[model samples]
Target: MATALVTGGAGYVGTHTCVALMEAGWEVAVLDSLENSSSAAIDAVAEVVGRGLRLYVGDCRDNSAVERALTEAGPDAVLHFAGLKSVPDSVADPVRYYRHNLESTSVLLEAMARHGVRRIAFSSSAAVYGLCKELPVSETAATRPANPYGWTKLISEQMISDVVRSDPRWSASLLRYFNPVGAHPSGIIGEDPEGAPANLMPYLLQVAVGRRAELPLYGTDYPTPDGTALRDYIHVMDLAEGHRAALEALVSSAGQVHTYNLGTGRASSVRQVVAALREATGHPLPCREFKRRAGDVAELWADPRKALLELGWSADRTLAEMCRDAWAWQSAHPQGYRR
Candidate 1:
């Protein structure tokens, strides 16, 4: 069987990707630090996939450890998902963010090159397009990251591009993901943030589950229809499947770095998301609308034609499905894996 190494494979997106890869007939090994994820999540993947996961608890920045992991897994490709992702946290500790996000990715790429692992699917973000004035941001949009977290991702994407350019034998797929929400429909795995959730879906889930008092609408003064920020929220499962497509594309292409934007191409405001959550959970959730948030864009979605054309992938899940699955996971695991 072919082998693949998934960095940060125990986290939300990474864990789901592991399941998708296993279903696609790839032997998978996960390397994670557990700083932002739980070992229980890894176990959940094992249970769902009906196979024990090869998990290594370590940092990606550790060059020797990365080398050993590649040597051990003998991965045919590396799904790069290991990085710090909180915008607020990145703002607070820019140095730490750069060290963990940018530096660690650099080390991982070096290790991959040294070990002759040429195929990679990097987990880039929409934040790399930072507050785009355009309505539907595409892969061709200018990359002006608004925060340090996004800056690190932009840097990492460039590094991957450069690596592929320098080595003709290396191939990579840079997948720029939009706002990824929802959870595995099975309710066994989901977005389980450690502290106060940075993203909207997790926060709304907390409110729906009565763990939090109310949802705080971060921006109510934007130029959008609801005067709030809008984002292209895609189901985590769809995002995971997109990873599989990207990996297949890179492996088949074999000579170029391809970029694709993964999203539903539909922008939903904060108010709209909250309303959908209330309907999905069948609860009276309170929402507190406030002033515009710092570093927030009025509207952002994706032009997924490229992905559809190239990878033959499009988000098949709906907003209702996203809310329903998230509600299922939140209601089932209120404390998220601790239960």
Candidate 2:
């Protein structure tokens, strides 16, 4: 069986992808810093997969730590997911974001080169295509990141591309994801953000479970059907499956840098998501309107046809399913993984 090293494997998407990788018969090793995630997540993943994974506790930017994981795990390819992901957080601290995101990738790449591991599947974001003018933005859309977080992703993509161009042995799959929400259907593993969540779904879930008072509905005056921002929210499990497909493609393809946007090809307004969560949790889910946050886009979705065609993967979960599953997880673990 092939082996893979997953950086930040204890985080939200990383944990689910670890389960998927194990189910697909790949030996998995996880390396995480436990900064924004809990090691308990890896335990839950072990339970879900009915097996344990190698856990290396450390930051991705630490060369010695990364090299230790690489040496001990001896993975055939690396699934790079270790990075600070909050956009607002990035806005508040651009240097920290750039340093953490860029340095981690650079160190990891160097370590990969040292170990002769040339294949990687990078976790990118749709934020890289900031302020997209076209609806359902394609892979070829102009990438003009509006925030430091998006700039980090775009710069990382360029770094990977440069490396691949310089060497014929290197292969990469850059998966630009839209909004990833929901949780594992089992409710054993789900998103557990530190402090307040910057994303919408987690905040809504917290409010549904009474952890918070009400949702702060940001910007209700955007040019949309409901005068609220629209986004493509894909289930976390579907996004995990997309990673598996991309990894498979990378294993089979030659030295080429492949990029694909992973989404449901449809947009859900903020009001629509609130309505869905209210129905799912049977909560009134009170909300109060607020001014639009800086760096926020009006509408953003994806034409995920590239991933569908190339990776043979397409997201199939409905918004209702997303909300229902999220509620299942939140209700089961009111205190998150700490519980």
Candidate 3:
């Protein structure tokens, strides 16, 4: 019925969301650069859905590529998930992060406007909250990004919001995702981070699968009960379902921007996560605590009530489920998509 053009459809979140969208009865087309992602993820998506998705292997920042995808797909909406997403890497290379993240959104939004594709669900991050003032961060919390990565995401959110305001044709949802863990549950399609996995769940999965020696605890001296940094880790599939809900909402509304926090609204410390994974994977999941990382916070979760009350979506997967599903994919393909 409706076609959706997904940027970065081969990426960890994008791939899973593609499956969710397809299952929800949307014809999906992908435009990806495959910079840090693999084409095999798309193939896995096809396998999971039992159908082929048209893919444009190109960068979202390229106007020509964006136009080509928009013109050809004739999508009813665009799900933008293409960007460089690493905090340390962004700190090291602010210019690259700003250029890549900002340019891609600007270019894509311009192209979408040109083609009259007005509906978009953007993959924003919790990093936009920077150092949170409140315990359970809500969508209304103040945003003061501590690094370039977070700044880029915040700016992109504003850009989309501005577009929706400027043109009555555009309706948008900016989903500020917390830690997205777990796989598709099928173990067929999952997160496949390149080089070294940056986040917690993937790294733990690698450790369980024998890729890493141990899960290096980033900070264990925090003020939390477990003396470790805390996060709101949501399942990837639930995050996908959140996107589905947001997109469906946007389709029926116009001339507005809705921002939601896609998280479980509960914080889990690193020690707790490691213990859960140990039970799920049958690995000791040993860890060595390190000094607190710079810019590290004690805890940051979500006040996800707005999303539940508005979009009827909330993360339903538990920590054990996250570990189990993540281990399933990582164990099946230890080398990520390269396998």
**lDDT scores of the candidates, listed in order:** 0.90, 0.93, 0.92
| Candidate 1: C-alpha lDDT | 0.90
Q: Write the per-residue lDDT of candidate 3 for residues 1-339, one digit (tens) a residue.
A: 989999999999999999999999999999999998888889999999999999899999899999999999999999999999999999999999999999999999988888889999999999999999787898889999999999999999999999899998799999999999999888988888877888888888888888899877887778889799889999999999999999999988899899999999988999899899888889988788788888988999999999999998889899889988988887788888876
Superposition TM-score, candidate 3 onto the true structure:
0.98
Off by over 4 Å in 1: none
Model 3, CA-based lDDT? 0.92
Worst 10 residues of 3 by lDDT: 330-339
- In model 1, what lDDT does residue 329 have? 87
Question: Model 1: which residue pairs collide?
Answer: none
Candidates 2 and 3, the one with greater lDDT = 2
Candidate 2: give the clashing pairs: none
